[model samples]
Target: MKITGYTDRLSVQPGENIKFMVNSHYKTYKAEIVRLIHGDSNPEGPGVKMEKVNADVNKEYNGRRQEIHMGSYIKFDAHPLFATVDSFSLQAMIYPTTPELGTQGILTKWSPAANTGYGLFIDDKGCLALWIGDEKGNVEKISTNQPLIAGCWYFVGGSFDKKSGKIAIFQEAVISKTNGKFSLPYEAEKQNVSNERKVNIQPFADNNAPFLIASVIEKQPDGKHKVINRYNGKIDRPRVACAALSKEEMSAWIDQPSGKDLIAAWDFSAGITKKGFKEIEKIHDISPNKIHGVAVNHPTRAVTGYNWTSEEQNFVHAPEQYGAIHFHDDDMTDAKWDVDFEWKVPDDLKSGVYAAHVHCGDDADHITFFVRPKKGQPTAKTALIIPTASYLAYANNRFQDIPLAQLMFGRAPVVQQEDMYLGEHAEYGLSTYDHHNDGTGVCFSSSLRPILNMRPKYRHNLSPSLWQFNADLHLVDWLTEKGFEFDVITDQDLHFEGAELLNQYKVAITGSHPEYYSGPMLDAVEDFQAQGGRFMYMGSNGFYWVVTFDPENPSLMEVRKNYGNQGWKSKPGEIHLSLTGEQGSIWKHRGRAPQKICGVGYMAEGFEVSSYYRRTEESGAPELAWIFEGIAKDEKLGDFGLVGGGAAGLELDIYDEELGTPSHAVILASSEGHTSVYMPVAEELYFNIPGLSGEENPRVRADMVFYHTPNGGAVFSTASIAYCGSLSHNNYDNNISRLTENVLKNFLLDQPLPGAEKQQVLTKN
Candidate 1:
């Protein structure tokens, strides 16, 4: 028997000795023939195709062969038929064609004995056939029968298996055992594959039969099927191994070839568990001389950790490993990359600072390490500062309370005894706070920042000046002791001109919680940069509201709420902020500056920092070598581990690591660290602001980070109050100090860098 077309509407042509086979492969197959019926004038006119003979399908097979007799009755059923042209509706008819014997094919329903049933008969020509339901209601004879579908070939096959109740179809050419009985071969090592293979039945007889593709089939109310891709259910030939062995037999050999390796081999065979086993560690000892290192590149995935080899480009793998497995290696054991970046620092190399960054080929994760000289002790310079208004003392014009005042001034600021849990503030109205409670108090003045009105009063029995706000200022004294000239300016001196002093220094900063700000204080720093300046912002919740300062009423500026009164329309207080569609609502119209600004914006979906993108060593930033001195080799751009719901460290929000633009900012660190709130990163530019444009007009250019003007006017911001003290604790103070010294001596004091021969260091101590 020879197999012809295997399609939705399949068929087999007639030939005496040739047998037709049908089974799982032929479940949707059928056969038919078209004989032109003559009109009044001619014999070859347009007419319907007639079915000479057709075969019936019995059951699904596991490759085992089953046969049917040459003249056996073949039922033509269930396969849908469609009209090729508008001429007529396509029809099927048995030999000695008749409109009787129930023309439209029989509707097979749920049968208890079998998943599906079959019916067939033979023609006087010895051609195998069966009746399609009776068209004229004559069900007795085989001579009058109609075909069910068209576009198919048909012939007779051997008798079906009585016990197993199946019919097998041949994929390849095979001689028939009987005149019409054809044999089929079971699935074998034929393809040399070792994974799972699948086969399904059609008209599947709705008996809770499992689907071939997925695990389960959820039946819809309308009697249709929806396969549950996840769970498992009753499936036909569910999961057969590449070896065609059952589950028990396959599991027995798991330890030998390794479960994962074996699963990879049989992946294409049948559907199994979604999570496959991973291969054990395999270490290959290659000659150190023959290869510098290895490099594995995934075109589809991020290629990471390939900086220790020469010619680290990648090519497709050999056929053996192609699509052989489905899994994500935990520690990246399955793939190793080695590229010759030579990743080593020279022993005698001039020392300053260094950083090493690493990334995963799949863009999985990034880590960085900072390396500095161990010999020279760094003086306090770089400072991290935090500015808050949670501490402010005022009286309510009450009776004499001198004794209470003296006691409160001795220790820390006193917490309030009364809770204002009235009305909208009733959430924690009954909450009591002492010095040990570390909670805020409540005041009724709308003039102060919101936090100050909520500070506790009774707890400050020690030193009133040693409160939260004062504690941060005291940290400035400690940094100064370490030779760092850093100071934490409170809201008392929250002025723009105060920050513009950075032009005389360098590396001014901001942070995670300096929620209250003045417009002039913001503008003074921008002006300082109009000359030449550098700034750094490592905070969140930077700028979202507009604080109004009426010069005529000095100290009476309006601190607008998030989005006017009831918070922003988007996420209320935290996420919504006005936008100029450029940098951020915080700095956008803050005056004129010379740089295309891009940094972390004010407000966060939450305090949590999200993983975005990363930059590999391939990103050419030679200057970064000087900035991030002691970091790991394979790191990339990401968060810095200081982000979450209540973290104080607001990381850089906007950064294009790959672009490496001098104007383009590197706001966030190269890993999940801090969530940046206010980040100012830019070079310098010149522009004219229109005076009539309100916050839009300006004339002059300036830097976004630091200030640099020809008239010795500059600004120096050392971050928020708490950050200033935190930097001293970490020696970042020293870096900032040196940078300050450099700026003063070179730009403000009109001195050249150390390499210059004649210029004097005007700002040196």
Candidate 2:
């Protein structure tokens, strides 16, 4: 009950055994975790040994150090072992058995050797023995035969009535089962009266003796009970029946049925006719069909099934022998029909779909099923529905796809220009959509309004008529070469409900100058990609602003910018507007960054682009030589504008270098001139910054990145938009022609085209 070194008070019920958990010093002998009891105390009558409470000498130390004889001021070194809340109730109760000596030395006495055993005896034979404390301490013994036995155990329990002596002891002997079954108790067990053995009727005499506890195995640290006689010269008796029960016995007591608390064991309906059946409410089919009869096989190795349907079902199948799900009758076996033997689709199932059928018997009538080899899958089929605006220009056309006209002319409030011609005096062109036609029509004039107003901030240089035409042309050519298909309608061309479009197309393609998009168009594409659709950008300043168009109004889309509209922060007219916010933003608005977003913003760095390095065997250039099948390794990365420092004709330049790409994505090629941009908020800001933030900016790493859907459909992107139109603008067939063919074949056409050869792994010392 006495506590020390703890702030929290301990509590226990009446009659509960008290345990003092103390942190004491260690002595000469390596201290083992122990449980102690006073076995022998000095100068008393017959003394009992002090048993070890709990000690562990298992800890490895340098040496035993030194040893000391009895009473030589033992300095036991100790460490504090923190006690948990549950450790308080772990100590066992103690019963004293020391002072019942009868001067006969039969009931309690010291050993003749003076430093040895005290134990229990039966039929003039020692049955159990115990020693505690130091060699100089006293020992106790019990030399009576009634309670001690050689090969038998006596279980003492209670029977409240006194007629049969109130206390009952069943002397049941242990017997082992010869067969692998339960061991039954031995018969002919004896029962004896308490008065059979003569002991003076001293009702208050202490007869409990100390028991020695040590590990049954000499090498291990364990505890056992050894009973010792306190009276008979410390007769050593290392015997006490083991009372430990198996887990089943403890569970029986814990889960036994009770009458007072009578919880119905038969809570379930005994049968369908049971009154307890509360109209078994219709159970909905919550389990998916893919998991219906599936048995897990090698759960670690992911095999594609229903979960991988999106990645174009390109996952590898199991070996023929292990292919459990057999759809054909030729391969069906008794094992195949066994529902107990269905293959377990791994949680990490690869991206693809799997199908298998089983016919229980040799009849045509059978069950057919399918599994998508993916974990989380869309309920709807994945497909791509090209928007009406894109349909006009491309429509699978390589020569004259009208991606620009499809985007602009299809909407209301058509753009207008003056009717004018270049080259000759007689040449003239018609100004179709303009309200007031002037002599300025038919001139190829580029304005900075669209670029400036489309900025996410700074609205001063705003102009309605920006270089929309140029943006349109670039998008159209890029789309055509990439082989994207589209519908050719003005406004009401392409629209759908929910995330349906994403399920069809693996990727949704857009343009740089997609500065204007109707609300519905934006929502559709956003939902599409969010549902796992891949998206590619070919033009600059795409998804720049927010516009709402009403068919009822019959006017141009209402362009909202500044801090006025609800979505002004994302509106295109605000200047440098972005398409996406964060990584997963529905729009994922990003923008031009001469220094931050794009390494090269505005027209400043456009003029400095020049090709440097050529293909070299050491650089793994020849490995991708197939990508340039008709070109040599010595060729430049690409040929575009001449090397200069002034305002270049193009906004982006392509060269050769290395850039990091996502594991799931591929880097087809890279360029050195392309700089990297810095945008700390690109992750949290949920928007792309436009224009150069400052001179201290990171350069863009020009790379042609490729991303494929789970089903193997893909989208490709180049660092620069200048290569949008010409396959060989400067008689440079290697760069433009090779890239265009690769993009078109792999992405839009879904062709089984050749890819770069795997690079060899080199080991260095």
Q: List clash counts for every candidate, in order.
A: 178, 118
Put down candidate 1 lDDT per residue, 1-765, tens digits, no spaces.
Answer: 111111110111121111222222222322221111110111121111111211222122222112111100111122111100111100111111111222211111122223232222323332223222122222222322222111111211111222332222111111222211122322322311111111122222233333122112335555543322111100011111112233233334322223321211121111111211111111111112111111111001111111112122111211111111111101010111111122222333221111111111221100111122122222222323334322211211111123343232222233333212111222111111111011111111112111212221121222211123323332333333444443233332335235433333443444334444545455644554454444444333343333433232222222222221111121111111111011112333443211222232321121122232233343235433333334443443222111121112222222222322122232212222222221222221133222311122111111112222223333322222222222222233333333333433333233422222211122221
Deviation in Å, model 1, residue 757 alpha carbon: 17
Model 1 superposed RMSD (Cα): 34.5
- What lDDT would each prediction earn against the true structure? 0.23, 0.24
Instruction: Please estimate how well model 2 matches the true structure, expressed as its whole-model Cα lDDT.
Output: 0.24
Compute each candidate's TM-score over C-alphas.
0.28, 0.28
Q: Tens digit of lDDT per residue, candidate 2, span 207-249?
A: 1221111111011122322112212111111111112222232
| TM-score for candidate 2 | 0.28
